[model samples]
Target: MLNYGILSTASICARYIAGVRESKNGFVYGIASRNLENAKQFAKKHNIEHYYGSYSECIEDENIDIIYIPTMNAIHYRWAKYALECHKHVIVEKPFVLLKEQAIELFELSKKNHCFLMEAQKSVFLPTTLKLKELLDTKIIGDIKYINLSAGFPGRFPEGHWMTDHASGGGALYGSCTYTVEFLSFLFDEPSYQYDAHFIKGKGSADDVVHFTLLFNDIIVSSVISMCCALKNEAIFYGTKGYIVVKNFWKSNGLDVHIDGNMTHFDFPYTSEFVYENNHIQECIEKGLTESPVMNKEKTIYAVKIVEDLYKQM
Candidate 1:
């Protein structure tokens, strides 16, 4: 079994914890947070045995082989680097890091330490996403032209949340648009793409919204990720032949394929999407692979480039 410990008590852990608990090859051996009470309560609620008052404790614990990072958008690089230096495998939550430099450095550290590392991009690992990619490869959507994705939640965090701060890596792209970028890169090979971005600053630490357009060779794709106003979420891919509409990219529960105005529906597997990711991580480690085939280093770099470009625009 691949023993695991969550590095944060953030809400994202709820999804990942459930997935690990449900996975046959994984176990949530421990949990850590800044607050001892939160750590203990999370551990107790999940039926987890060990709880640590700080992230360092979890990293130092010998029982855990992998550290699952579900921390804030800004702290990903720091904790991921710490986990690697400690000789622990790492599965970081999406967007991996704020800059391409950080992503490259973490990958290098993993190689130097002889440990496995993976970025937790959910869409690429979920069965539903795989099926959609298969369809795209079969020309189900014909030659793609434009894809639009929008997602936002109103005041999901506190008044002065980091997501509202630009320096805090606060923006839709770093926070939510990672899913949309991952999807496009997955289908378009992550290369031969150009990007553009704009951000709307709010009173918080990051931008309230982000708008970006992607160029895949000759194809044009656009996405709008908002966070300032009310909550709304949607993703859809348009092609020469038809389009696929996904209700929520983050949840990734279901989708609709439309061709010539004909509709076909697809529901994601009943199994937790995060479970599939956990399963994939263990399988890669067992196979002695450094990264997931679906979300390999090159693609990881490509995804990072997209983010880097967006930041430049902002």
Candidate 2:
């Protein structure tokens, strides 16, 4: 089995750990946190075999085939680089790194070490997202005209929380806008586009509210993401012949298609949304592939560029 070591006891790891435990060829072997107590508690709750007080200890474990990094965004590059140096494959949470340059460096490091590296972009691996691509490619939605996507949630984070600190890579732009930008970029095959964003600050220097518009070849994708309010968390596409709508687009198992005034619903069976992405990672590792075909390096860099540009305009 592929032994997995989680680099942090962050809440996000819980979903992925559950999925990895269910995988036929993967399991969570170790977990680490800055605090030994946090690590021990997380490991016990998740039934992990090993726990470390530091991320370095987790990556240094010789038995770990892969490491999952869900740490704060500012430190992702450092940890990922170190994991690659240890010759361990890595899967990093979204908003992969703070900059495109860092992504380039990590990809180079992974190539040099001959270890696999991938962004944990679970949305692209969703059955609904795959079906959306298939339908768009087949022109089931005809010529695409416009797209609208929104994702956000009102959270009760205290002052000094990472989500509210700029130094910690906290913001709706990094936490939420990344999703909308990635969705549009994937849908259009990384087409040449123009992006602009407006923001509202909440706690940290980061923007809690963001509104952006991306101009594609023949489509205009508009997005609004905020930590100050709750959004429908849906994606809508309008085309010449029809349109498509995905509710809960981030973890959806089904989609609704509208063609010629008729609506049809499609569903895909799975235990958890993370299961598909975890399975994909396992297959790639077993096949000796270094990057995910769905969320490859090229697209990752492209999405990073979008985020960088958005920050520039803001």
Best by lDDT: 2
Segments of candidate 2 deviating more than 4 angstroms:
none
Which pairs of residues clash in candidate 1, taking residues 3 or more apart in a chain or in different chains?
A: 164-204, 164-205, 164-206, 165-204, 165-205, 165-206, 166-205, 166-206
TM-score of 1: 0.94
Worst 10 residues of 2 by lDDT: 176-185
TM-score, model 2 to reference: 0.96
Each model's backbone clash number: 8, 0
lDDT of 2 by residue, 34-57 (tens): 999999999999888899999999
Write down the lDDT of every candidate, Cα atoms only.
0.81, 0.86
Instruction: After the best TM-score superposition of candidate 2, give how far the Cα of residue 259 lies from its true spot, in angstroms.
Output: 3.0
Candidate 1 segments exceeding 4 Å error:
230-232
